[model samples]
Target: MAIRRALISVSDKTGIVEFARELAAAGVQIISTGGTHSLLEKEGIPVIGISEVTGFPEIMDGRVKTLHPAVHSGLLAVRDNEEHQRAIRELGLDYIDLVVVNLYPFAATIAKPDVTYEDAIENIDIGGPTMLRSAAKNHAFVTVVVDAADYEGVLGEIKQGGDTSLDTRKRLAAKVFRHTGAYDALIGDYLSKLGGDPLPERYTVTYEKVQDLRYGENPHQRAAFYRRPLASEGNVTTAEQLHGKELSYNNINDANAALAIVKEFSEPAVVAVKHMNPCGVGVGADIHEAYQKAYAADPTSIFGGIVAANRMIGEETAQLLSEIFLEIILAPDYTPEALDILSRKKNIRLLRTGELASAEGRKSDWVVTSVEGGMVVQESDVHSISEADLKVVTERQPTAEEMKQLLFGWKVVKHVKSNAILLAKDDRTVGVGAGQMNRVGAARIAIEQAGEQAKGAALASDAFFPMGDTVELAAKAGITAIIQPGGSIKDEESIRAANEHGIAMVFTGVRHFKH
Candidate 1:
C-alpha cells in the first residue's frame, strides 16, 4: 500500500509543523484531533478533523473523539490482505499510514505540589494510548511514532525512500509498547501513592534507553543506562558532564552513593566513596578544608575513589584533588580555573551535577536488588535517626561528646551496606566495615582499623545486634559508647553486656540498613 494518510497529534509540538508539511509534500493526507488540528490549520496546512472522518462530534470535552471504530479500523487494517481491504472498502474506512502522538503530561501534573486528586485523574490519557496500540499492532501497514525526537528520523526515511521500511516500522512498534508500558507504570505509581500501598499488587517499571556504557562492573559484561520511569526534573540520570571521559558502571554506582551521602550534610561537606561505601567524609568551614580533611581521614582508601562535594569546586580544592588518582569528581559547579586544572587529567570522569540536592527529596523509595530469578526491594536507609529517638537501654547514658560522635557515626553508617559498622571520633570517620557476613565480624574489622583511635571513638551499627557478641567485641576494643537500633529478641542480653563493660549504649528506635 502506498503511504497516503498520516495522523498527527502531540502535546509536545516541537517541530511538528515542519514534519507535517513534509508529509503533505509527499502527498500524505493529514488527519488530526482538536488542539493539534487548530495548530496545523493556523500554520495554513490542510488537516481533516477526526470528528469529520468518524461522522461523530467529539463528546465529553473531546475525550470521546478518536475512540471510534473508524479511527482504529483504518490503523488496524492490513494493506496486503484481501479480506482487510474488502472490509475497509465495505466500511468506507481510509487507511492511516502513520501515527504521531505524545501522551498528556500526567507525570508532570502529579509532580506539582499543589496538584489536586481530580486534576491528576483527568490528565490520565485514554485515546492516545488506544491509537498508539492500534498503529503499533498493525506495523506491517502502519508506522507509529511516540516521541517528538523520532520525527526527524521518520521524515528522513520517508524523504529518502517514498515510504518507511518494514524494519523501521518494527523498531517503532517496539518503542510504542515500551512507551505505553511506562505510561501505565506512572499511573500505577500515582494511584499507589494516593492510596496507602507501598508496593503495587503487581510491579510495573518503565525505563527509557539512555546510552550503552563501555561495560558493566567489568569490561567483559554488557551495560547501559536507563532513566527511571517517572523521575523528576533533576536526578543522576539527568546529570551533565562538563568534561572528561565517559563514566564506567562502577563510576556511576560509586558516584551515586557519594552524592547521596554528601546531600545529607547541609553545610560545606565532602564524601569519598569506594566500592559503593563511604571511605572518608567530613564537614568543614570551606570546600577546600572539607576536601583536605576527608582525604586525610583515610588517604589509602581514597585512592581511585569517587569524591562528591556539596559546594562549588575552588582552585585550591581542584589542585588537592588533582594530586590523587581519582576515578570521578562531582560538584555543583567548577570554577573556570578549577576546570582548567582538573581537565589536565584526561581519564578522570568530571561531572557537574548542579545542585541536585533538590533531587534527593524525590527518592524515598527503596533500593532494589535482583537475584538469579527473584528480586527484593526495601526502603532506602535515609531516615534521620535523631539522638532524641534513642532510648538509653543500658544503665549508663552516653556523655555529651559521645552522643555527638554517635549521631555523626549514625549518619555515616546509614550509607554503608549491611552488616555495617562505623567508628568515628570528633565528627570524622576513623574506620568503616561494610558488607560483612556477620555483625560481630564487622565490629572486629572496624576496631582493627581504628586501632588506638578506638579507645575514645564511638561506634554506630546499621541494625540491631542479634546476640551480645558484637557488644562484647566493642567493649574489648575500648569503644567508649555504642549506638544501634535495638529490636532483637535478646535485646536485654546486649544491654547487659554494655552495662557489664561500663560502656555507654543508646538504642535508636530506627534502623539504618542500607543493603
Candidate 2:
C-alpha cells in the first residue's frame, strides 16, 4: 500500500508548504488547484495542476474547477475491485491516495460586523467539501485530513508505512463529516437569518468544542464544554480563567447563572449563585460595598458559591473575597494587587470577563434546555420594569425607599427558580426562596432566611399569589412593600391582606417565571 498520488487543496494553508514538500520528497505526486497550485510551484515543489488531470480550464470564478469526474473518480475509485481496476485502466482514471483539504471560512466571514451577503456567499467552498466527502466515503482506500492539527500524525504514519492505517483513515473521515456538517449548518443558519426567520421550522445551530471536563454534574457521568461561535461578550463561555483548577460541569453552570443575574444592572453589582439559582445579589456605589452587601445577603449560602460582578475587583474587594472559600470569582477585570492576592489561593477559579461594554445590553436571544429525547428552545427572558411601569394595586403606595428596594428585588427574583421569592433591604438581597411548590411556602422560606432582616425588607415574587396566604405570611414577617405580577383570580384577596397589614403592593402586569 505505498502512496503514489495525493490531492492537496486548502483555504487555511498553515503547514501546506512543508507538508507538500515532505510528501513530494517521499515520491508522492501532488495534484493541486487554484491558490494551492501557485503556492506549491512557488515553493519549488514538484506538482501537477488540476486542469492537467481534468483536461479543462477553471471557469465561473474558479467555482467549477476540481468538480469534474476525474477528481471524484480519483478520490472514490476502488483499488481492489477488478471491474473498478478495469475502469481505471481502460477509462484512464487515476486513484488518489490522500486528500488534504479544509473548508472555506464561512463562519469567520459571517462573524465580521459588516460582512455583506455577496461576500459571505462567495466564501463558501463547493469543490473542497465535495472532494473531502468523496475521499472520506472511501476511507478504506483513501485518507482525508481536515484539521491542520492532524498534520503531524498523518505525516508520521505516511513516512513510516507509506499509507495511513484503517483506524486513522476512519477517524479522519469522521472528522471530515463533522467539519462539513458544521459548515453546511452554518450556511443554512445564515440564510435563514438573512431571510428574517431566525428560528425556522427546522432550527439549526452550530458550536465548537471548548474542552472535555473531568465529569458531569456527578462523578459517575462524563461531560464536555462547547461554545456557540457568535456568543456575545460577558458570557460564561468567553471567560478567561486566570487562576485555579479546571472548571467542572457545576462550576460552569453556576458561573453562567451568576453572570446572568449580574448582567441585569448597570451599576456596580455582584451576584452569588449556587445550583443554577441566585442565592444573593447586591448593588452599590463601588465593588467593595457591593461585595460586602452580597456576602451579608446570605453568608451561609455564599460559601463555595459562584460570584459574578460587573465592575473590576479592587484590592480591598479581593481581600474580603480571599477571606472566604469560593468556587469561582468572575469580573470584567482585576487590579494587579487584587490578582496577586487572589491567585495565592490554589483552587478558586478567577475569570476575567472580556468586552462587556461592547455587548450593548443585548444579553441573549434564545434560551435552550435539554430534555430526554429532544431539546426545547425559546426566546430568552429579557424583561425589565421601572417605577413608572408599576401599578398601585393596593391602598398604600410604596415609599421612595421601598420603591428602590422593590426594583432591585424584582431584577434578582427573575433569575431565581419558580416558585420564587426574594426579600431585599436597602441595596442588597436579604433572602431568596426558590423552587418551592407553592407561593406561601416560598415566602415562608424567604422570611425564615431573612430572620430579623425581613422586618423592613421589600419582597418580590416571580408570579402572582394564588390567594392571601403568601400576603399574610409576608405581613407576619413585617414586610413593608411587595411587588409581583398581579393577574390571579384571587388577586383581590392578596390585595385585601396587604391593605389590612398596611403593606404597599405594586404590580408590573408581567411575570418572570424561571422553571
Candidate 3:
C-alpha cells in the first residue's frame, strides 16, 4: 500500500499547502476539488481535478462531484485481495491511498444571528462525508484524515515508510466517522429546532470542556466542567473568576444555587447558600442593607457558604463579608474599594458575572437529574405568585406588612430542599429548616432556630401541611401567619387550627417543592 494518489477537499485550509508539497515531492499524486485545487495550483503544486479523476463534469452546483463509481471503487478496493485488485485494474480506477476531507461549517452557519433555513440546508456537505466514509470503511488499505491538526503527523508517518501504519490508519478512520456523526447531529438539531420541536425522538447536545475541578463533591472523586457553545447570556457557567484559586465542585454547585435565588428578586438582594440550599436571603433598598440582613439571618450556617448579590457590592458590604470565612462571593460587579478590602482574603473565590435577568427573561427553564442508568428531565420551578394570587383561608387576614414578609420567605423557601420551612421578618429570612422528612419536623427545626424571634414572624411552607399538627406547633411557637399551597386533604383541619390559634393563613394555590 504505497502513497500513489490522495484526495483533498476541505472547508478549513490550514497548513494544507506545506503538507501537500511534501506529499507531491514524495511522488504522491494530489487530487483536489474546487477551492482546494485552485489553492494548490496557485502554490505551484501539481494536482489533478476531481472531474478528471471521475471522468465526468460536476453538475447540480457541484453537489454531484466525486460521487461516481471511479472514486468509490478506488477508495473501497481491498489492496491485499487479488480479486479486488483485478476488478480495480479492469475498471481502470487508480488506487486512492489517502482521503483528506472536512465537512462544511453547518454549526457556525446556523449560529449566525440572521441565517436563513435555506442557507443552513445548502451548507450541508454530501460528497465530502461520502468520500470520507468510503475511505474509512476500507481503512485497512486506505488512509483518511478529517482534522487539519493531523496533517503533519500523517506526513511524518508516510515519509518514515511507504505508507501509514495499520494502527494509525485505524485510528484516523475512527476519527472520520466521529467527525461525520457530529456533523449529522448538528444538522438534525438545527432542523428539529426549526420545526418547533425542542425535544425530538432522538436528542443530541454538544459541549466543550471548560476546566477540570479540584475534585467532585468529595476528595476521592474526579470531575470536570463543560459548557454549551453559542450562549449569549451570563450565568454560573459563563461567569469569570477574577481572583482566588480554582473553584471546587461543591463551590460551583452552591454558587449556582445562590445565583438562582438572587435572580428571583428585583431589588438589591443577597443570598447565602450552604450545601446547595439557601441558608439566608434578604432584599433591601441597597446591597449593604441586604448583606447585613442576610448575614444576620443565620450567621452560623453562613460560615463556609457561597454568597451572591444581584447588585454591585460596596466597601461596607465587603468589609462585613470579610468577617466570615466564605468560599466564594459572586456579584454583578464590585466597587474598587470593595475589591481592595476583599482582596485581603486570598482564598475567597471572587466571581464577577453580569446582572441577573428578570424571572421572565431567565434562560434555564429545564431541570435534569441523573438516576442509576438514565436521567429525568423536566421544566424548572420558575413559578412565581403575586400578591393578588394569595387567597385568605382563615378568619384573620394577613396585614400588608405580613404579606410582604410572607412573599419574601416564599421566594427563599422555593430554593430550599424539601420538606422545607422558612420564617421571615422585615423582608429577611430569620430561620430555615430544610431536607427534613416530615412537615412538622421541618417546622419544629425552623421554630427552634427562631425561638423568641419567631413571635410575629411569617412562616412560608414550600408545600401544603399534611395535617393540623404543623399549624398547632406554629401557633405554639408564636408564628403569627402562615402561607402554603393549601392543596392537602386536611386543608380544612389546618385552617380550623389556624383560626383557633388566631393565626392568619393564606393559600398561594401553587406548590414549590424543591427536592
Q: Which candidate has the highest lDDT of all?
A: 2
| Pairs of residues clashing in candidate 3 | none
TM-score of each: 0.92, 0.98, 0.88
Q: Which ten residues in a row have the lowest lDDT in candidate 1?
A: 357-366
Give per-residue CA lDDT, model 2, range 59-94, as digits (tens): 998999999988898888888998888888898878
Global lDDT scores for all candidate models: 0.87, 0.91, 0.89
Which regions in candidate 1 have their CA more than 4 angstroms from the true location? Answer: 229-235, 356-363, 466-468, 489-497
What overall lDDT, based on C-alpha atoms, would model 3 receive against the true structure?
A: 0.89
TM-score of 1: 0.92
* Tens-place lDDT digits, model 3, residues 1-515: 68889999988899899989999999999999999999999999999999998899989988889999999999998888899889988988888999999888887888898998899999999999999999999999999999998998899988989799999999999988877887887788678867987677776666666899989989999999876655555578888888899988888889989988998898999999999998888888999999988988888999999999999898999999999899999999999999999989989999999878856566545466779987777778888878899999999999999999998888889989999999999888888999999989999999998888899999999999989999999999899999999998999999999999999999999998887
Q: Write the per-residue lDDT of candidate 1 for residues 1-515, one digit (tens) a residue.
A: 56789988888788899999989988889999989999999999989998889999999988788999899989998788899899999988888889999898898898789999999999999999999999999998889999778889989888887678899999999999988888988899778867888676786666777788999999789999887755553346667887787878888889889988888877788999999999998878889988987887789999999999989999989999999999999998899999999999987888888775532354576567788887777766556756677889888888999998898888789889999999988667888999999999898888888888788889999999999999898888889899998999999999999899998999888887766
Best by TM-score: 2
RMSD of candidates 1 onward, in order: 2.5, 1.4, 3.0
Better candidate number, 1 or 3, judged by TM-score: 1
